[model samples]
Target: MRRDILEHYKSTGTYTYAGPYSEYFKSLPDDIRQLGNLICSQVIHRVTLREGNSGANSDLRYGDMTRFPWYRLRCEDDVLMTAAAMTAELFRLDDRGFTFQRATENKIVVT
Candidate 1:
């Protein structure tokens, strides 16, 4: 399942820009489509350094266990804001790292 997600990321650059969500979305059950869509609508995406970069500069790069680059889910809008709060409540009960300020209106900007 993990490998399948990595393959999907390599084939499409969307997840790299949007974060490592395609797999998480795909793993969702049919009943959870709404939640998945909510995640899609709210999370900001980002890509990490390439595999080869580690050899060139350790500080500048790191390898992900998955072949695809590591993605950061930026939470900045109502959709993302809600989602982050929910995710934090459920999975990160003790951690508030998932919480973030509302992003700028532009989807591409993290603000």
Candidate 2:
């Protein structure tokens, strides 16, 4: 990862820019989609950096572990991390002069 990108994230509280993660983010259409893409990529990146590999489908703690049903149900931290990332992304957008409001029924997520 580039030092500048890290610094930018630390300072801005968002990867909502879609530049550094162009391969994934640019094609994602919205901040929420981009963030989800970013998080998935980070999981692979972080696991490889720490374990010297992506841990494939074996390690329950990182890598392609999310592919497992039990892993998704049991890994509690993932839920928190995702919520936090979404909040941060939204907050950063608000800070960037975007305003939000309550609306009618909407799909919060897709399965």
Candidate 3:
């Protein structure tokens, strides 16, 4: 079922959120939805999937989907992103923030 959706996205390079899949995805559990969000983002934004393991077979992108766990993400290159995330955590580099406006006498929101 999901594979058909993926194939459709791959073929058309278009994304739709209001179809039957929207409620279907909303009903899914958190962990699975995490991956689903990633897939949707990649499809809509055309983000390239990282080749995690240098020696991993490229043909085995989604291996053994019938199993409980998918190891595709486990094989991605995590070091650079992990370092950036750690630095962001250390520096509190979040995009959402607020500051006081002296002239308007109000708080300004940043996001």
Candidate 4:
């Protein structure tokens, strides 16, 4: 995903999170941190499928899904986002959607 973002940026000379994904980048540290945030946001906003590695495929054979809700996240690149925020964002993108009430209700766990 990181490579994909870099290649996309190299080709388009434009960023992914300069618009819709900005809020997710807002919490990132300043300086070089924003670059990481930008790259991550772009990948997450662009890629699809959050499944972990499966024995059926070599690429899916490695990776930890317990610590990361790979199945819940729509984008494999979202691992870089705050766990809480990413979870919330995923929930927001879910069929049920999100609401301020749900956000405050601890439905989203950050750690």
Candidate 5:
């Protein structure tokens, strides 16, 4: 899966400009990237759950793994945000039948 994701990123140049966070995500080892992809695959859609009313009746959830510090260490907020943006862009690009080039060596502009 990691190889496939990397191949798609390379082939389509679908990189996201994550500022300093680009290095953090790009430098991740293959195993870690695979793990991240696995987690992301599980969360392709938005999820919400009802909570007993205590002022809050509903809660938005990404994934339970997101609450772990170790997961956060491996996938920082910036990285996750950028990934989400990139995924959205990927869908848009696919709809338009277009592929983009990387704007920089480390990242692709999110916009």
Candidate 6:
């Protein structure tokens, strides 16, 4: 799964979240971290499958998801977005100080 995820990013030129959230991510339980990675992989795969089935050209723009090959979940921006959302939901489930916020258009603040 990790290899596939790396290959997907390489082939698509999509960014992955490797920023300041590293510490927080590392602090997560092994199972949670694995699940997050898996979710991220699935998100990319599903989007690619949808685009391929839609018969549209794949778009590799920085932040466009309307056309084919959109970077909905294949870029750092989307990854952070998903992380923020997931953290918020998971925090509600278990108040574990795993907080993420979109500090800017392309930046994520994790705590």
Q: List the candidate 4 regions with Cα displacement exceeding 4 Å.
A: 1-15, 33-111
Off by over 4 Å in 6: 1-21, 29-81, 97-111
Give TM per candidate: 0.20, 0.20, 0.21, 0.23, 0.26, 0.25
The TM-score ranking, best first, is: 5, 6, 4, 3, 1, 2
Model 1, 1-111: lDDT tens per residue?
699888875563422332434454355556566655543432333432223235443343222213332342343333333333344333333232222222212222122
Model 6: how far residue 49 lies from native, Å = 24
- Reference-based lDDT, residue 14, model 1: 23
Residue range 1-111, candidate 2, lDDT tens digits = 999988876553333433333353335446777555544433333333334324453453333333323322322334424444543443343442122221101101111
Candidate scoring better on lDDT of 1 and 3:
1
Number of clashing pairs per prediction, in order: 3, 0, 0, 3, 1, 0
Which structure is stronger by lDDT: 4 or 5? 4
Question: Evaluated with lDDT, which candidate comes out highest?
Answer: 6
Worst 10 residues of 2 by lDDT: 102-111
Error at 93, model 4, angstroms: 8.1
- The local distance difference test score of model 1 is 0.35
Report residue 86 deviation for candidate 6 (angstroms): 1.0
* CA lDDT, every model vs. true structure: 0.35, 0.36, 0.29, 0.38, 0.36, 0.39
Q: Using alpha carbons, what is the TM-score of model 6?
A: 0.25
- TM-score head-to-head 1 vs 3, winner: 3
Please give the range of 10 consecutive residues that has the lowest summed lDDT in model 4: 41-50
The C-alpha local distance difference test score for the whole of candidate 6 amounts to 0.39
Q: Residue 14 of candidate 5: its Cα lDDT?
A: 32
For model 5, residues 36-60, the per-residue Cα lDDT tens digits are 6543433323111112222232242
lDDT of 4 by residue, 6-51 (tens): 8866452232333444564465456776555433332222212233
